[model samples]
Target: MSTTFPLLTATAVLPALGAVATAAVPAARREAAKWLALLVSLGTLVLAAVVLIRFDPGGARYQLTESHAWIADFGVRYELGADGIGVAMIALTALLVPFVIAAGWNDADADIEDSDAAKQRRWRPTQGFFALILMVEAMVLISFAATDVFLFYIFFEAMLIPMYFLIGGFGDRAHSGGEEDGAKQRSYAAVKFLLYNLAGGLVMLAAVIGLYVVTADQLGEGTFSLQQITEARAAGELTMGTNIERLLFLGFFLAFAIKAPLWPLHTWLPNAMGESTAPVAVLITAVVDKVGTFAMLRFCLGLFPEASAWATPVVITLALVSIIYGALLAVGQRDIKRLIAYASISHFGFIVLGVFAMTSQGQTGATLYMVFHGLSTAVLMLVAGFLISRRGSRLIADYGGVQKVAPVLAGTFLVGGLATLSLPGLAPFISEFLVLVGTFSRYPVAGIVATAGIVLAALYVLLLYQRTMTGPVEKPEIAGMPDLRARELAVVAPLIALLILLGVFPKPLTEIVNPAVEHTLSDVQKTDPEPEVEAAK
Candidate 1:
C-alpha cells in the first residue's frame, strides 16, 4: 500500500483551501459560497473514492502512506497513512459532508437582519458558517489519515474551534425558548462542549508528553510516531512499567471516552446537540466525535496493548452503563433533538462495547457500527430538523399526526428510527448483532444485560414515532405541515438507500472492515474466543 504520491495530503488540503476561498467570497454572495463549499466537498469525495479504489485490503496494513520530516529534533514527522479502518472512516466522512452541507442550505440566513435577534447576532456572516464547516472537514480528514500521534492530536483539538462557532453562532432557529433564551443556551452549550473536550485534551497533552519522554529513554530519541513506537515495542527494545502504562493509557482513554462521550463523560452532548442546528449536530456525532473512538483503535490499543487489555473490564462496564442509561433517558425525553442525542449515546455504548470486547467480531462490529451510525443518524436528525423547523418547537408535545400531512418525512424518519433501534433488514442490525455475539462469546452476563438496551431502544424509538408521526393531527401547526421538500429529500434518501443496501449485502463494507479488525486484534495480541457449543459433528 506504499505510494510516492501524496494522495492523502491532497485529499485533506482540498477542503482546507476551499474553506479559505469560501470565506473570501463576497459577503453578499452567500449562495456562491455555499456552492463553492459543496463543490469542494464533492471533489473531496472523488479523491476519497480514488483512495478507496487504490486500497488493497489484502495488501500491506497501512496504505497510501506519506511520511516526511516535520520536527526531527523532537522526533515528530509529518506522517500520514490509512489502514482499512482509516480508509473506511475517511470514506464515511467524505460521503456525508456534502449531505450535511445540502441539508443546512439555509441554516444560517445572514440576510434575516430585521429581527432584533438577527441584529443582536450581528447578522452573523453566512460565509463564516460554511467556511467553518469545510474547515472542520479538513481537520477531521487529517485526523483519520494521520499516522503520527502528534499530528493527529494537533488536528484533533483544532477541529473544536470551527465546531464551537458552528454550534454557538448558527444554532437551530426552531427553539421553543424564544430567540434570546435560545442564544443564551447556545452559548452555554458551546462553552460546555469546549470545556469538556479541552479538559480531556489537556490530560491527553500530559500523556502525549509522557509518551515522548518514555520513547526518548527507550529509543534514544523522543518520538510520537505510532509506527515507530509500536515497532520498537514489538522488537523488545522498549517496554513500559505496568503502572506507567496504565497511567498513560488512562490519559488517552479518558480523552477518547469523552470524545466517544461515554456515560459520565457524556453530559455535554445533549446540550450541544439540543442547541445546535441539526447539520452541525450531525457533524458533532457523525464526524468530529468519531476521531475519539477511531483513536481508541489506532492509538490506545495499537500503542498500548497491555494497558488496553488491563482496562477492558472496567471500560466494558462503563459501556454497558452508557447503553442502558442512554436508552432509558431517550425513552423519557420530551425534546425531539435531545431524544436523538441520547439515542446516539446508547449507540456509541454498543460501539465501545464492541471495541473493548477484545474479539475479532467485536472490533469489526464496532468499526462497522461507526459508519452505519453516521448514515442513520444523519437521516433521522436532518428529517427531525425539518419537522421542527415547520412547527418551530423541538418539543415532542408540539407534534402530532405528522404522517397524515407529511407522510414522506414521517416515512423517512421511521426508517431512520428503525435503523437506530437496529431493526432487522437494516444496516445497524448487523453491526449490533455482531457486537452482542462477540461480547456473549466472552462475557455472557454483559451480553445479556446489553440486550435490555435493545428493548429500551425499541420503546424509545417506537414511542417517539408514535407520539410525533402517527397520531391524530391535534396540533394546529402540524395540519399544514408539508412533506420532505426536494432538497431535504435529496439529503435523506441516499442515506436511507445506503442503510437498506448495506443491510442486505454488507459484503462491501465487511470486506474492508474485516482485515482492519484482524490488524487491530494483532495489535492487542488477542483473538476471538472459541465457541462453547459444538455442532453435532
Candidate 2:
C-alpha cells in the first residue's frame, strides 16, 4: 500500500509552487495571476482524485505512504500517507479551492491602487490574495496527509500566518462604522484569532513534547511517527502512564477545541468569519477549521484511548451547548455573513458530537458531516457573497423581495438554506440523521437535547428566507439587483449538484468512510450498542 512515487507530497507541493508563481506575476496582470492560481488548484484536484482512485477501501489502513529521514536526532521523519478519511478531506480541500478563487475573482481588485500609499506595496495585492489561499490549501493538504506528529503541528500552526493577513489586509470594504472603524474591527478580529490559536498551540506544544517523551521512554528512542506509536500501542510494546496521558490529551484537545472553536473557546469565530471576504469566510469554516475536528479523530482517539473515553462526557456536553447556543445566536443575527458564521458553529457541534459519540455510525456521520457541511456552507456563503457584492451591504434588513428582482439568485439561496437546515433530500440530512441515530443508541438524553438544534436550525433558515427573499421590494436599491451571472453560477452550480447527488446516493462516501470509522472506533476500543427493539424478519 505504501508508494515510492510520493503522490501525496506532489499533491501538497503543487499548490505551494503555484502560490509562489502566482504571487510572482507583475503587479498589473491580475487576470494572469488568477488564471495561474486556478490552473494550479485544478491540477491539485486531479492529483487528489488520483489518490482517491488509487486507494482501495479494503487495502491497508494508510496507503500511498512515503517516509524519509527528516530529523534523526529527534526521530522525526518526512512521512505522508492517506486513509479513507484523509483522502476524503484531501478531495474536499482540493475541490473547493478552484471555486474559492473564482468566487473571489474581483474581491481584491477594489482599492488595488487608489492611493500612492497603496501603490507602494510590493507584490500585486490581487496576486497575494490568491497566493495566500493556495498556500493555505497546500498546508491543509499536508495536515490531512501527514503521518508525523511534528509535521502536522508545524503546518497546523503555520497556516495561521496567511489567514491572519487575509482577514486583516483584504477585509470587506463595506464598513458599517466608516472605513476607519472597519479597519480597526478587522485588526481586532485578526489579532483575537491569532492570539487564541497561538495560545492553544503553545499548550499543544507542551503536550506534543509530553507525548514524545512518553514514546521515547517506552521505545528506547524519541519518535514522532503516528504510525509507529499507534502500531506499538497495538502490539503492547508502548504504554503511557494515566496521569501523563490525560495531561497530554487535554493539551492536544485544547488546541483543537480552540481551532474547532468549541464554545467558550469559540468567540473568535463570529468576528473572523464576519470580517473576512466571503470566499475567505468559506475557507475559514468549510476548509481550515475542519482540521480541528479531523485532528480529534486522528490524534486524540488514536494516541490516547483511555483519556478520550474519560473526556467524552464533558466533550459531548460542550457540543450540545454549542449546538443550541450557536443556533440561538444565529436566530438573532441581523447581518447576513455573521448569521452563517453562527450557524457553522452549530454545524461544527454536530460534527464534533458525532466524533465523540464513538460508534461506527457516529464517526462515519461526523466525517460525512465535515464534507457535506463544507459543500452546503460553500453554496450558501458564496451566493451570499455575490448578493453582498452587488448591494455592498451584509445586513439582512437591507434586502427584500429579492426573488422578484433576481429570481435565480433567490432560488439558489433557498436551496442553500434548505440544505443548511438538513432537509430530508439534502446531503446534510443524511449526516445529521446518522449522528442522531448513533448518539441515541448510546446516550438517549444527549440525543434528545441535540434534536432541539434541528428545530432552531429550521427557525433561523426559514426566517432568513422569509425576511430577505419573500417580501415586497421595499427599497430603491432592491429594484435592479441582477440575477446570478455566468461566473457566479459557475461557482455555485457544481456544489448544488453535489448536494443533490450525495444526498440521494451517499453510498460512494459511506462505503469509503465506513471502513475508516471502524478503524477509529477500534483505536478507542469501543463498539456501537445493540438496539433494544428490532424489526421482525
Candidate 3:
C-alpha cells in the first residue's frame, strides 16, 4: 500500500467514505445501515490504534507527515500528521466514536414507529444520523491534522454543520418542547454558535491576511502555510509590531475563547447541551470542545508571543471566573445532564489557566487534562444516558433509591463520579496537580483560586451521585429498573480502564508531550525580544 494512504490520513477520510456508503444503502434495510455504521466506526478505531503504535513519541514535530499542494494560489496544502498531543487527541476521538455509535444503538427509537414500514423510515433517518456523525469524525480528524493554517480553518468551520443537525434533529426534546420551542432552542443555539465562531473566523482571516502581507513584505514571498509562517517568524523575517500583534491576538483569542465558551462568552453551551442527545453531547464535549483549547496552543501562543505574554493575566482572570461561575451554576441546576455540562465549563477553566500559565509543566498538564477530561466525561455521560433510558427522566428529583435495585449501576456511577472529582489515583488528579503546581510558580493568586475549583468539583460530582444513586429505593417504578447491560459495559469499560492506567503511568504520555511543548515555548522565547526583532531588519 502507498504510504500516502497511511493510517493517519486515511482515518479522516474513512468516515466520509462511510457516509457515502450509508447514503447508498436502501431505506428498507435500516438494520443493515446500523451494522454498516458500526463497522465503519470500529474500523476507524482500529486504524487509530495502529497510528498510535506507529507514532514516535520522541519527535518534536508532526510525525507520519503527509502533504500535497491543494490550492496552490492560496498556499493551501493537504497536510496531516501528529505530535504526541495530536495523536492522543486523535486516539481520544477514535475511542469515543465507537461509544457514541453504541449509545445510539438502543436510543434511536424516537424516529421510528411500530410498523415494519415505519421502522424502515426510522432506519433511513437513523442511518443519516450515523452518516452525519461519521462525517463529523472526519472533520475533527482533519482539523487536528491540518498543518496549513488555511486548511485548518476550512476543517474548523466545516464541523459546525453536522453538529447543528445532530443536536437539532436527534435530540430527545426536539419535538416535545413544541415545534417552536425545540426549533427555537436549536436554532438559537446553532445561530449563536455559528455567529460567534464566524466572528472569530473573520478576525483570524484579517490576521492571516496580515501575516501573509508581513511575510511577503519582509521575505519577498507570501505563504499561508503553518510551517512557512513558523519558519518565517522564527527566522525574524515576519514582523508585527506590539499593537498589531495585540489585535491579531484578540482575533485568534476570540475564536478560541468562544469555542472554549469561556466565562461571559459561554452562554451557548447550556442550551446546546440541553438540546443535544447523550452521544451528540459526548461528541460535542469530548471531541469538538478540544478544538478551542488546541487552537489556543497552536495559533495564538505560537504566532503572537509578545501579545500572549501581555494578555496572560487578563485571560487567567477570565478563566478563574469561568471556574467559579460554572461551579456555582452547576450546584443550582435541576437537570442532571446540564449540570454535568456546566461542570465541564469549570474544568475547561482549569485547563485554560494551566495553558496561559505558559510554563512547560503547565502546558503539559493542560494537555493531559484535556485527554483525561474527555475519557472521564464520556463515561459519565454514558452512564447518565443509561439511567435516563431506564427512568425516562433527566430530572434529579425524579430519581430516588436507585442503589437498592441497580447496585452495579450505582457502582459505575461511583467510579465515574469519583473520577470526575479527581480523587487520588484517578487520571485527573495527576494533571490537576501539575496544573496547580505549574501555575502557582507563575501566578500564585490565580493558581490558588483555580485550586478552589477542585473542591467545588468534588461537591457537585458527589452531590449528583448521592441524589441519583444512593437514595432509598422507594419509587416502585425505579425499584424495578435494570442494571447496566453487556452493551453498556462494553461501551464504558475501556474508559474506566484508561482512567486507572493513565493515573498510574502518566509519565509515558507526558514524556512525549513535553518535547513538542519545549519546541513551542522556544518559539515564544524567540519572539520575546522585540528590540532584537526590529534590529534584524
Candidate 4:
C-alpha cells in the first residue's frame, strides 16, 4: 500500500467521506447514495484485506501505527494501530457493511410512491442509511485502531449514536392504535438500547478519568495512551491493587458487557431486533456488538490483568448463564429475527468464556470467533430479510415450506444456520472447539457446562431451519416465494466461501493472530502472578 497514508486509517476515513458525498445529492437523485455507500463499503473491505496480506504475523508490537497530537494539553493524540485482533475485527466490520447495504436494499425504499400519499411517505431512507453506516464504520475503525485508553473509550461511546438512529428513526414503526403496537415498540426498543448503553458508558467515563488520574499521579504525567499505561504498569509505577483495579475493570466491563448484552444486560437486543431493519440489525448484532467482546480483550484484560484473574470465576459464571439462558430464550422465539438475536447472545457467552479462560488458544479462539460470528450473522440477517420481504411477515409460521419455492434462499439460510450451530468443518465449529479446548485446560467445569450450549445451539438452529425451510408444502404463500436472484447470491456467496475456507484452512488466519495474542498474554502474565496461598498447616 501507500507509505504516507496507512491503509488502516484510509479504511476508517473513506466511509465517512462517502457518507458526506452521498448526503449532498438532491432528494430526487438520492438513490445514488445507496450505490455510493455500497462502493465505499466494498472499498473498505478491500483495504482491510490488504492489511491482512501485508501484516507480519510474527511482529511483537502494533504494525503501521500512526500517532499525532490531537489535544496537546490533555495528552490525547490522534493515534491508530492494530495488532492481530484489531486487524481481524477491522476485516469483520468491512465484511459486514456491504451485506448490510444489500439486506436493506428493499427496505431502503420501502415506502416509495405508488400514489401521492405514498410519495409523501418516501422520506429518503437512503441518506439516513448511508449516514448511520458510515458513522458505524468510522466508530468501529477508531475502536479497533486506537492505542490510547481515552481514545478507545471515545470511539466505544460514539458508536451508540449512529446505532440508536439506525434502530429508532430509520426502520421504526408505529402501532395502529394500541400502546404495545408498531411504532411504539420501536421507540421502546430504541430508548432501552440507548439508555442502557449511555448509563454504562457514563460509568466507564468515570473509570477512564480515574485511570488517567492514577497514571498521572504515579507515573509522572505520561500520556493517557494505552501503550503508556502498559509501560507504566510494567515498570511498577502503576499499582494494580485489588480494590482500585476491580473498580476500574468493572467500569470498562460493564460498558462492554452491556454492548455485548451479556446475560441480563442483553434484554435490549431482542426488542431492538424486533423493530430494526435487517441490515441495520445485521450491523448492530454482527459488527458493532463485536466491539463488546473486542473491548473485553483490549481494555479489561489489557489494563487490569490482576483484576481479570480475580474476577474470572464471576465472569465465567455469568457467561455460563448467558449461554444457557440465551439458548433457552432463542428456542422459544416466534419472531425469526429475535431468534437470531438470541443466538448472538449465546455466541457471545462463548466469546467471553474464551477470554476469561486466560489461555493463548482460548483468547485466540475468542478473537477468531468474533470474526466468524460476524460473517455468519451477516449472512443470516441478509437472507432472513429477503425471506421476510417476500412473505410480508417475521413469524416462522409464515415461512413453512418456503424451500419448495425459494430453494436457493432456503439453501443459503441453511448454510448460515448450520454455521451458527457450529457444525463440523464450518468456521464456528473450529473456534468453538478451540475455545472449549483452551478453557478446559483452565476452567474445566465452565468448559464442560459451556459445551452443553453447543447442543442448545443445535436445537435452536435446526428448529429454525425446520420451521422455515422444511416440513410440509402447506402454505400457498410459501410456494410463491421467489428463489435467490443473482444479485442476492452475489451479496451472500463470498461470506459462505470465507466461512468454509477459514474452517478448512485456518492456519493462514491463525498465523496472523498468534503474534498479537502472544503479546497480550505476555502483558497479562507480567501484571498478575498467582498469589501465594497459605498452606493448611
Candidate 5:
C-alpha cells in the first residue's frame, strides 16, 4: 500500500522553515530559539513516525513518493520516497534532533575559562547555533528521502555547510591552552573534514555525469533517476562496459568510503569530532555518517552490482583493518571525545562489512546497526557533555571517582559504554551479532578476525569507565560535583530505555528491515555463498 501525502517533502522543509523562524527572532529572545527548534523537530519526528507506521515492509519499492519534474530538460525530478531502510534512517535522524537541542540547552551560558581570543570566537550557542542544527536536519532528511541521484547529491553536499559551522563555530577550545592555538586547531579539523568530503563529492560528480552520459547513449536521453538507472541495468538495456561500470562504481564508492571514513580515509573524523561539541559530534558520527553506508547499499551496489561483487575481497579486508585499527587507537586515546570518535570508526567497519557481505542478514544488520549506533552514541556523547560541563574538561585524566559525587551520571555513562561495547542485553548487541552471523556464513575468515573487535570493544569501554568513574576521589574539584540533574536525565532516559527495549524485543525493527534487505539483495542479484564443512568435522 502506497499513498501520496507529501509527508517526505514536509519532513524535509519544516526544519528549514523553523531555522528561518528561529533566526527571525530578536537577539534578546535567543533562548526562545531552542524551544522553537524543539517544537519543529518534534513535529518532524511525528511526521516520520507516521511514515514509519504507513510504510509497508513487504513492499519492495519506494513508497509514499512525491515525484515531479524539477529540471525537465535535464531529466532531473524532485523525487522523495522511502523504503524500509530509508524510513529507519529518516526516523533515526528525526528522533535524535530534539534530544540534541535539549542536550545543548545550557551550552551558550555554560561558563568556561579561556583566553581572550578564544572567548571572542567561541560559539555562544544562541539562536544561530540552533538554526544551523535545524538546517542540517532538513538537509539530512532530504538526502535520505531523495530518489534522484542529482537530488541526493545536492542535499548531500548541502548538509556540510551547517555541520562545518557547528563544528568550528560551536566547538570549545578546551583541548589546547592558548586561544590562538585552540581556534586554529578547530579550524584545521573543520577544514580537513570539508576538504576530504568535498574531494570525494567532486569524484562522485564525475561519476554521476558519466552515468548520465551512458544512460543517454543507451536510452536516447540523459537521466539521473536512481530507479530508472537500476531498472535499465536489470533489463540489460544500459551497458556502459565493465571498465566504465567499475570506474563509475569507484567514483561513488570513493565518496562513500571517505564519508564512511573507511580505514585510512578516516583520519579527518577523530580531529573533527574532538574539536566539535558533543551534540554536533553525535550529529556527524551517528546521523550524517550513515549516509555513506546507506549510499553504498543503494547506489554502489544497486547501480554497479558486478563491480561491488568483484570488489568485495578488497572491501572486506579494509573493514577488518578498520575494526582492528580503530579499536587499537581508541584504547590509546586520553581525550574522551576522541576516544568515542575512534570507537565509532570501529563500529562503522562492522556496518560496511555487513553492507558488502550482500546477504539478507548482513544488509538488515547493517541498517539496524546504523540506528543502534546513533542512539547509543548520542547517549555517550550527551552524558559525556554533562560530565564536561561540570568538570570543565574533556580529558579522562582530569576525572577520577566521579561516581562518588555523581552516581547517576556515572550510571548513565556506564549504560552508554555498555551499549557501545554491545553488551548482551543492549541494542547494539543484536545488530552486531547478526552482522557476524551473516558474514561468517559467507566470509568465515574475515568474520572470525572481526570478532576480535568485540574483545577490543570491552577493553576500551571498560578502561575508559574504570579510569574515569572508579578509583579514589583524588581531584578536589570532582569530589563535590553534582549528580545528573532533572534536565539531563530527561535528555538521556529515553535513549537508555530504548536501548534496553530494542535489545530484548528487536522483532519490530527486524521485521521492517528484513524485507528491505531482501529487496536490496535481489537488486544486486546475489546470494550468500554456502559454507563448506569438513567430512568428519
Candidate 6:
C-alpha cells in the first residue's frame, strides 16, 4: 500500500516555527527562550522519531513523499521525502539539537566579572542564539529531506546564515587575547567560512543550471527533480558528452568536498571550531557537515555514476591525504579546540574514503560513521567546552592534574577521546572497522595505508589526555576545579550511553543503513570485487 502524508514537511518546518516562537518572547524573559527552544527541539525530535518509526526500512525507495510544483516552467517543485540515509541523518540532527541547547544554556551571555567594556561589546542576547540554532536545525532537516535538487541547494545555502551568526556572534571572544581582537578573529572565521562555502555553492549552481538545460534540451522542458533526472539517465533519455558529464560531476563534487572540508580545502574548519561556542562547533562538525557526504551518495553517485567511478581514484587519494594529514596536524596542535577540529578532519577522511570505496560494507560503515562520529564529537567538544569554561583557557599547557580535581570530567573526556580513536568495544570502532574492511575488499593498498592513521589517532588522543588530565597540579588555579554538574551530566550522559549502546548493538542502525547502501550501489551499478583464493600447495 502506498501511504502519502506531509510528515517530512512538518518535521522540517516545525523547528523554524519554534525559532520564531522563541524569538517572540520579550527580552525580560530571556531565560525562557532556552526552555522554549528546548521544547521546540524536543517536539521536533518527536516528529523525527515518528518519521523513523513509520519509515519502512524494507522499502527500497523514498517514503512519505510530498511534492507540489512551484515553478512549472523550470519544473521546480517543493518536494520532501526520505530514504533510509535521509531518515538517519534527520534523526541524528533532531537528537542533537535539544542536547546542544542544554549544553549551551548560558553560552551567549557575557561572564559576570568581565570588564564593562568587554561585556557591553561582546554579550550576545540569549534568545537570538537559541533562535539561530533552531533555524539551522530547520534548514538541515529540509536539506536532508529535499528530493528536488534546487530545493536541496536552497536549504543547503540557507543553512550557512544561522551557522555564520552562531560562530561570529556567540564565539568565545574572551579566550582570544583581547575582546576586540577576538571578535575580529571570529568575524574573519565567519567570513572565510561563508566565502569558501559560497564559492562552492556558486559552482554547484552553475552545474545545476547546466543539468537543467540538458534535461530541457532532451525532453523539451526543464526539470530539477532528482528522481526524474536519475530515471532519465537510467532509461538513456538523458545523455551528455563524457567530458561535460565529468565537468558537471566535478562541480557538484567540489561543493560537497569543500563542505566535507576535505584536505587542502579544510583550512577553514580549524579556525571556525577554534572560535565558535561548543554547541555551534557541534552543529558545524556533527550535524551540518553530514550534508556533504549525504549529498555525494545521493546526488553525485546516483546522478553521475560513470563520472563518480572515473573520479574514484582521485577522490580516494584525497581521502587518504585527509586522513594522514589531519592526524599529523592534530598531533601538533596547541589549542584543544583546534586539535578536536583536526581530529574531525581525520574522521571525515574515513567517512569520505568509505564512501568512494563503493563497496556495500564501506558505504554502510560511512553512514554509520556519520552517526557515531556525531555522538562522539559532540561529547568531546562539549566536554572541552566545560573544561574551557572552568579554566578560562583553550591552550593545552594551561591545565594539569585535572583528574584529581574533576574525576568525572576527566573520565568523560578520556571516554570521548578514546571513542575518537575508535577504542575497542566503542561505537566508532565497529564503523571504522567496517569502513576499512570494505575498503580493503576493493582496494587493499589504500586500506592498508589508511590503517596507519589509527596509530596517529592514538598518539594525538592519548597525548592530549596525558598532557592535560594527568601529572601533578602545577598551577593553583587548577586544584579547585569542579566535577561535572548535574546539568552537565544531564547533557553528556545520553551521548555517552548512546555511544556505549550503539557500540554493543549497532545492528538496529546498520539494518536501516544497509538497504540504503545497497540501493545506492545499485544506482551506481557497482558491486564488491571478488576475493582471490590461494591455490592449495
Candidate 6 residue spans exceeding 4 A from truth: 1-4, 111-124, 174-176, 534-537
lDDT per residue for candidate 3 within 247-305, as digits (tens), equals 88897788888787788888777777766778888888888989888888887887888
RMSD to truth, every model: 1.9, 1.3, 5.0, 3.9, 2.9, 2.3
Q: What is candidate 4's local distance difference test score?
A: 0.83
Please, what are the lDDT tens digits per residue for candidate 6 over residues 434-475?
999999999999999899899999999999999999999888
Q: What is the Cα-based lDDT of residue 134 in candidate 2?
A: 99
lDDT by residue (tens digit), candidate 4, 303-322: 99889888889999999999
Model 5 clashing residue pairs (backbone): none
Models 1 onward score TM values of 0.98, 0.98, 0.93, 0.94, 0.96, 0.97
The sequence of per-residue lDDT tens digits that candidate 5 reaches over residues 418-520 is 9999999999999999899889988889899999999999999999999999999999889889999999899999999999999999999988888778778
- On lDDT, the candidate that comes out on top is 2
True-vs-predicted CA distance for residue 114, candidate 3, Å: 2.9
lDDT of candidates 1 onward, in order:
0.92, 0.94, 0.81, 0.83, 0.89, 0.91
Error of 3 at 75 (Å): 1.8
TM-score of 5: 0.96
- Screening candidate 6 with a backbone cut-off below 3 angstroms (N, C-alpha, C), the clashing residue pairs are none
lDDT of residue 350 for candidate 5: 98
Which regions of candidate 3 are displaced past 4 Å?
1-5, 116-123, 174-184, 526-537
For lDDT, candidate 1 versus 5, the one ahead is: 1
Backbone clash count, each prediction separately: 0, 0, 3, 4, 0, 0
- Ranking the candidates on TM-score from highest down gives 2, 1, 6, 5, 4, 3
Writing each residue's lDDT as its tens digit, candidate 1 over 1-537 gives: 778889999999999999999988875577898899999999999999999999988988888999999988988899999998999999999999999999989887733565556555533467788899999999999999999999999998999899899989898877777888888999999999999999999999999999999999988889999998888988999999999999999999999999989999999999999999899999999998888889999999998999999999999999999999999999999999999999999999999999999998888899999999999999999999888888889999888899999999999999999999999999999999999999999989999999999999999999999999986998778898988889999999999999999999999888887898898898889988877788897
Q: Judged by TM-score, which candidate is best?
A: 2
Q: Which residue window of length 10 is worst by lDDT in model 5?
A: 109-118
